[model samples]
Target: MSRPLIYKGRGSLGNAAGRFEKHTRRAEDDGWGSLDAELPPLQTEIIVDSSQSVISYNDSPDIPFDRSINPYRGCEHGCIYCFARPSHAYLGYSAGLDFESKILIKPEAARLLREEISKRAYRCAPLALGTNTDPYQPLERRQRIMRGILEILAQTRHPVSIITKSALIERDLDILAPMAEQGLAAVYLSVTTLDRTLARKLEPRAAAPQRRLETLDRLRAAGVPTGVMVAPLIPVLTDPELEAIVSAAHAAGAQSAAYILLRLPLEVADLFEEWLRQHYPLKAEHVMRRVRDNRGGKAYDAAFHQRQSGSGVYADLLAQRFRLVCRGLGLTGDLPALRTDLFRKPHAGGQMSFDFFD
Candidate 1:
C-alpha cells in the first residue's frame, strides 16, 4: 500500500509537483487532495550551507534597524500567517509544509559575524536578531547556532536587539543581563493572543501565551530591558483581545509595547485562507473581506508606509483602538537606545584594548 500523502494546504508534501519548477504553466490546475487533514507529522532535514555572508541589510524607511541576522531559515514555529513562508519557494520547496519542516542552519554564522565586525570600517550599531525568521526556534535548542552568535556579540560589546516568542530566550539571560546593564541590549517578546486554544492553532509551535508572559517577567527582573509586541492582529479572530493583551504585558513588567496589523504576503495569503476556512469557517468570509478592504481590494499591499498598518476604515479603527488602549495602560513608550560608545573590538589574544591609553 502506498504511503498516505501529507496535505499541507498547497499540495502534497515531498511530491515533485509541489516543488516550484521553471517553465511550468498550469501548475495550479493539477488536482490535489482534500484540504482537510489531521495534524501533519514533523519531518526534519539537515542542510549544510557554505556561504561567506550571513548579515542582511534592509533600507525600508519605516523599519527601525538596518542590519539583521537570521541564523536559521524556515522557522519551525509553523505560524499559519507567517510572511516569510514565501522564501522557501526560492529553494524549489513548497511554501506550505516545506516552509516549516525543512530546516536550514548556519553553523558558521559566528565566524562570519566576527570577521565582519573586526573590519576596520565596521561600524557599531544595534544588530537585530530573528528579524526574517526566528533565531531561537526549536532547532536552536540542539544546534545552538543562536547561542554562538550571541557569544560573539557579547565578546565584542556589540549592541544587539532580539525579538522572539520563545521562553528559550530566558536561557541566555546570563549573557543578556550584563549587556542590558551596560545598555547594549534589549528584547521584544511577541505575544499575539492570550487564548490558549486559539494560540495553539494560530501559532502551533510557539510557546504558550502564559509561558511567554512569564518569560517577560523573568527578563525584567533580571535587569534586562524588555518590551511586548502584539503582532499580526488578526481581524475578528484575535483582534478582540488586543487591549487585554497589552494590559497584561504592562502588568507583567514590560516597559513598553507595540503592534502590527496582520500581513498576508505572497504564499502566506493562500495558507492563511486555507487555515481560516478550516478552523473558523463561520468567520472566514468576514475576515477576508476586512483584509481586502484594508489592502484596497487586494490580497496584500507592499507599500512601505501602509504595509505595517493597513489602509481603510477598519484598519484605522483597529489602529485607534490599539493607540487608546496602549495609552490607557501606560504601555506606549520606546526603549532607550543602547549605547554604542562602549563597543570595543576584542584583540586577537582574546583581550580588548583602547587606543585612548596610548
Candidate 2:
C-alpha cells in the first residue's frame, strides 16, 4: 500500500478515515513516536466513469436552472470549503485527502449530450455547467470532454451557462463567442478571495484571482457575456474581501455579480475542520465561530433559502452589505436570459433543422 503525505500543490488534511468503513484509524503526532513521518506524499488518482446519461435535472426551487452537467465527479481544485467533498464518500473514498487526489472523468459525456439533445421531445433551456465540479479543471486539458460538449452545444445552437474558477474557459471562446452574440451563452467566474496566499490554500489547484480576472476580461473582449460570482463567502475569512472581489471583477469587464454563503454539509464539516487545523490553526476557532453565528449556531443550515443566505443577524448583515455594494455598482439580480428559440434539433440523418412555424 502507498503511504500518504501532503503534496506541495494540493489542499487536504491528509487522508482521514473513510466514513463508511466499519473500523476507523487515527493518526497521532505526540512527537515521541509519530506514524505520520513515514507516510509517502499523497498523489492524484484518476478514475474513469461510465455514465449512461449526461444531463442531470432537478426540481429544487433553490436552484435557478432545471438542468446541469458535471463533466467530472471529483474536482481537482481541492477547495477546503467545497460542499461537494462529501459526494466522494458515496464512491467509498474518504471525504478528506481522497476527495482531492481522486478524479473521475466521463469520457463519453459529449456523445451522451449529443444523443439527449437529439430527442424530438427535448426541451431547450439554459444548461448549467460546473454546478457540481469544475468543467475546466486541470484534467480538462487532457480529457477535452468539456470542449467536445461545447462544440455540440454550439452546433445545435443550445443555450448554456458556465460557472468556473479556471482560466482554461478562455480556450473555448471560439465556440462561446458566437453563442453569446445570439444570447445563447453566459459565463460566470467564481472568485473567493483576492488574497493569493489564502487562495493557494483554499483551492490549491484553481486559477489565481488575477488569472480568473484576466479570463473574464478575455471572454468579454471576445464578445462572450461574462459575470462574476463571489461564492461561498466565509464570514470573517473571505468575507472582508467580498466587496473588493466584486470591484475587481467589475473592472475586469464583468457586468453581473452574485454571492453565496459557505455550505458545509455532511462529511465536508470534518474535511474542512481538518484543513483549518492544518493551515490556519490559530484562527480556526474564531473563523468557525463566525461561520456558526450566521448558521443559527450550527456549522450549516440546509433549509432552502437559508442555505444560500444564512439566517440571523449575521446573515442579514451580509445580505445588506451585498445589496448596498451591488446597488452602488449598478448590478442587479438579473443575468441575460439565454435564447431557446434558436435551438435546432438534428434529424435522424444528422441534419439540423428548425421549423419557423413551430
The lDDT of each candidate is 0.82, 0.86
Per-candidate count of clashing residue pairs (backbone under 3 Å): 0, 0
My TM-score estimates for the predictions, one after another, are: 0.89, 0.93
Flag regions of model 1 displaced more than 4 Å: 1-20, 23-40, 348-358
Candidate 2 weakest ten by summed lDDT? 349-358
For model 2, the stretches where C-alpha displacement exceeds 4 angstroms are 1-5, 26-41, 349-358
Per residue, candidate 1 scores C-alpha lDDT tens digits across 1-358 of 1222344322223222233665432223223533334646556676876778888888999899999999988878888888888888877776677777787889999888887877788888899997778888888999989998888888778899999999999999998998898898999999999999888878878899999999999999999899998988888888999989998888888998888888998778877887787778999999999899999998899999899899999999999998899888876679989888977776645444554122
Model 2 has an lDDT value of: 0.86
On TM-score, the leading prediction is 2
User: Which candidate achieves the best lDDT against the true structure?
Assistant: 2
Residue 59 in candidate 1, Cα distance off native in Å: 1.1
**RMSD in angstroms between candidate 1 and the native structure over all alpha carbons:** 4.2
In candidate 2, the residue pairs with backbone N, CA or C atoms under 3 Å apart (3 or more residues apart, or in different chains) clash, namely none
